[model samples]
Target chain A: MSAAPAPRYLARPLAAIGRPVLAGLASVGRMAIFTLTVISHLIRPPFYPREFAHAIMTIGWYSLPVVGLTALFTGGALALQIYDGSSRFSAEAAVPSIVAIGMARELGPVLGGLMVAARVASSIAAEIGTMKVTEQIDALVTLSTNPIKYLAVPRVLAATLTVPVLVAVGDSIGIMGGWLVGVNRLDFNSAAYLKNTIDFLEAADVASGIAKGAVFGFIIAMMGCFYGMSSGRGAQGVGKATKLAVVASSVLILGSNYLLTEVFFSG
Target chain B: MIELQDVHKAFGDKRVLCGVTLTVPKGESMVIIGGSGTGKSVTLKCILGLVTPDAGTITVGGQPVTKGDRDAFLARFGMLFQGAALFDSLTVWQNVAFRLLRGAQKRARAEAREIAIEKLRRVGLKAETADLYPAELSGGMQKRVGLARAIAADPEIIFFDEPTTGLDPIMAGVINDLIREIVVEMGATAITITHDMTSVRAIADDVAMLHDGVIQWTGTVAEMDGCGDPYVEQFINGRADGPIEAVR
Candidate 1:
């Protein structure tokens, strides 16, 4: 007798779900192991000073032009948008103050953070990911060098220090962008716009943005290095890791931006 | 000398290395032959500390490799990857001098470049090739560059993973000759993993067959062809209808 019709469709979906769940769990486990390994290596010695310097130069110094340009345009566009929106309520006079405060407290840091995350995160991930795929990381390990100490720590440290600096620069440039637009497009006097911007912005606003920059920086570098070290062994694996690093860093920046804004602005 | 004492490695439910035990005396060339996915590469990785064994002790020069001092253990060896995994970002010279450009081995930039060029020349590459990136080179050239980099530091122990997998017959012979010459010149202990019998005949003083994650047969090159094991016989003869079944 033919067996009762087997539930083929049910079995397929069940197996599909089971496979992804297991894969997700395995990925999480691998991430945890990698994180612990990196932290452990950070505490060890024989640190490579030269590699650290190179990372600073590569991730921090080389990234300034793009960060600067992005901030400048964002600030200008923001000022124009504020002007256009505020005119409906006869609040055009508030444009300078709003632009200054907004850029310093949120826009500058978050946008700048996202920009750097896109640029630096992809690069770091691609470089390290390729190294991993090709067994260069293994070669490093064989050469008596701790891969994390030689690779991750330097990039992470550089990003942490450099991103805040980029934020500060971006904030200033963004404020200037607002000033230029406010004076030209809005027909506001240059002196009055500058005074309003300076008066409305406080040290706390700048500090908060810089602090956010530091956090974003950490996330960018951490995600890049993390995905890189765990990349699979092929060109496709490196490409996938690079794409994931950028996407993850951007998402983390936005999410953490909200949390940080709440913490800083809660009072 | 390198010794693997009953090593076993498994990934989750899939056991790759069941009980692999082998030895390479100092200054000897040992070639491990196996088909794809039979754990040949894993064995080399385990010896290099890249892949840890589930149960085994690997010792290099009588020092336990499982200890925390992987760097110290690794410093004694150099490896040529299956893909000739050269750094694409760096120029050929920079890739060759990767180790020399850092730490105590750090040389003056010019000296480093010079040495890198010299190594490149030894591998039959022109000095002009030193400024080129790995991507600009053909597969055979990349393999030669990889060989040059492997011997760049004059390592006491060397590992060659599939040295002749993707090359033409003539290029493969060139690589085999280079490997043999380098092993003899450096007086280094060499472990090569490949299925190429030509490479085995050219470079190996001893031959080991890896099957089911263990050394199924091992003997001197002279004795390899005469090994009575059916697996060895099938593998050396390239016969499909023998003990080894095609997975298809």
Candidate 2:
């Protein structure tokens, strides 16, 4: 083939590389437009209160048990690990303070968000994706209802408002978990451990974690809806959207968690 | 009255509608026929504003279809989707009264339910059927519920998309007859997109054949038989060897 000519050969590889990059950029642009549409509809008239209430009950109330379980186990494990590590330098007494700070500042919001993403995001994506495939979304439009307002905004608003509350509950339950482990397993003085946890955790520490939760909740519900509206083809398309909803929401929660931490404590 | 002038649309590289133009005068039922994927449904969607046209204007009642008061605009029109797109989450009555439950068409909950029951009765559904979800109904029952919802608000304009695509011949004939009676009784402007000649003869005052993204023929149903347009002739006769491919 005469080596395929040097310039043409280089052009083929370059075009191949540019193709995926272009597609990715286009995907991002589409998502940005969808996000803006959702936000605009959020403030407009004809808001659906029934739908919003239903979403709050689904995303917030139904999600509490799993969140509680995850917080409890994580808190206990965290206390044990902190006690073991801090003992090397005769610093075992620091377990209560560290566990309180850790649960309140990071683990509470991040883990609760990821758990909700795993549970709720996938469900929202699957439900909406199936609706798209079955043409119910189109039916809603033809019936003089805006799908963004009826479907997306309600779920997103519910998540944003409820997740911070969930994070607060998770934080309390988590601290209790640490207290139980510290008193029963770690042999720490009971009153002293409680006093240290309470003293080390400032108002800002709890506020910062709950605030992170609100951001994570927004990302979780938005990704579910974003992928759902953008779903394609058929059963396989819905399946892919469900998977991406969970994966994207989890990654976004962790990434935004780090960014929010930097902002809240960088000083 | 409704009119489309030089409407154009495309999905990526596939140009689904290229310069489609047509008009339906007040109280007339216009049927658009074309082979699969030749943009028949896209034409209906363009009029409904579900799919935006890349070019040209659509007007309803001598006003541009895209402008002001969308709720008021859509409230004047009703559409029966090809797949009977009822909300599975709701019972039959809820789906029928969906429009009445909110917006400018809002009604008291009890009144809306009563109207839903009345519409269901008109479509031959029993009041007891109103409490059943769409999934619990047979396909024909579901289609009737969809039809009930379409006419629940007593729209000034009604569009039926593939009204008999997936029904047995007897059920299809029943649906076609009901559609004919309903359209005549209401005197509503109707546009139906379907390739079924039986439905055409049963529903159309005027017929338009779409081919290759444009109107291939336009005339009354009486003229469709003698217009000598090969595309219309081939399509109506279901010929495999002529213009519309047996396999596009």
Candidate 3:
């Protein structure tokens, strides 16, 4: 009897797990269809140029200060860490080249992209998710305005354009931070550190990082729009969607950072 | 001006609306009354194309409401949702002038704000209220702002979905009276869905009782007292026992 009950309990748990797995698959299928529908709507007419312009200003220009501050500080800290670590092996001479390459190829774009994903993704999801909960999305449809074009396209475009620029600026500042640390902290000459950084960093490293930034930007905005549009009814639903957007964007950024680095750096 | 013919809607295994049919003539105020979950709100949503009926036809101003053309069809109608449904990010003036600032009716910001403030005043709100957000307003004031927005474009048809649901008796009466005045002034066809008898008596020219997703009886306010239908009687009198089941 005891053995029978144990097996029955195990069966129930197995069934419970199976149900959610199926449900999750179904949800993914529904989301795919919704995404396709949104894309189709995006290419159609009745475009709202004014709304697009406003979104670009809000998502891109307004977000610059936060992204800039994050990138600058991260670069400065990275330089300090690299200098300390390299001095252990009596390889202090390699500090300038390693810092320059590391910042341009990985740290600069990844940190900048992650910071933006936090700021931009959360804001987009929260704003649009609230609109969805309140039936304003329905109201927009009733008013003959296409919600995808008015809401999604502008955000996606702004992130795509702005993140690359953010990455580029971040790369320059990060290299400058490394240069400062190599000279001031590691007792390296300022002129030699600057020359070494300039010599070691190649155009491909910068280009690849910026390219990753653009892709990261697209992923961040897409996740935000997707979650916001699919938010369920009421305040709790909006809050959940906002949290999911931030988490999803952050995960995708880190994962993509690895993949992009592999692609760019593999021998 | 709005007519539904044998409308039917079901969610999964549960049937909410089962062949509901009703009509509201032009320049008239019709109030639909029903207990909760009997499809009173669903009927209004069907008419507005907010909810698509599984089977049946809904027409407005003699034109059929096709699925994709809901926007153009809805443009002629104004709606006050159950909870006001104001945009939280927008100021009171912006919410009121939303439609006016879109499409062909687009106005300059200053002009839109001026019109919005005027409408706010018409709803008995102060000019300073226009700069505030909907969150800052009282429930009654939010409903008033919703009313202002609904009538802002002077739509030929207006829908009030439980306009008095969350208000006190006095506030509900005020809203009912305001609705009556606005409908009369605009000469527009208005459909209001409510369970509030006070709202029914105050605003309805004709009253329709929806029981079990069908119109049990429809008549003028004078005729409602003499309706004689047991279901209608049970509802209007708020009796505990009647022919209608208390449980599903």
Question: Candidate 1 lDDT, tens digit per residue, A142-201?
Answer: 666677888898888789888999999999999899888888887999999999988888
Clashes by residue pair, model 3: none
> For residues A237-260, what per-residue lDDT tens digits would candidate 2 score against the true structure?
999999999998998899999899
TM-score of chain B of each: 0.98, 0.98, 0.96
iRMS values for every prediction: 1.8, 0.9, 2.0
Q: Who is ahead in lDDT, 2 or 3?
A: 2
- Among the numbered candidates, top DockQ falls to 2
In the range B146-208, model 1's lDDT, one tens digit per residue, is: 888888888999999999999999999999999999999899999999999999999999999
Residue A63 lDDT (model 2): 92
Model 1, C-alpha of B230: deviation from truth (Å): 1.8
TM-score to true structure, per model: 0.90, 0.94, 0.89
Q: Give per-residue CA lDDT, model 2, range B1-248, as digits (tens).
A: 99999999999999999999999999999999999999998998888889999999999999998998887889998889898999987889999999999988999999999999999998888999989999999889888999999999999999999999999988889888888888998999999999889999999999999999999899999999989999998998888878777887
TM-score winner: 2
Error of 1 at B173 (Å): 1.1
Per-candidate interface DockQ score: 0.57, 0.74, 0.48
Higher-ranked by TM-score: 1 or 3: 1
Q: Where is model 1 more than 4 Å wrong at Cα?
A: A1-45, B104-110
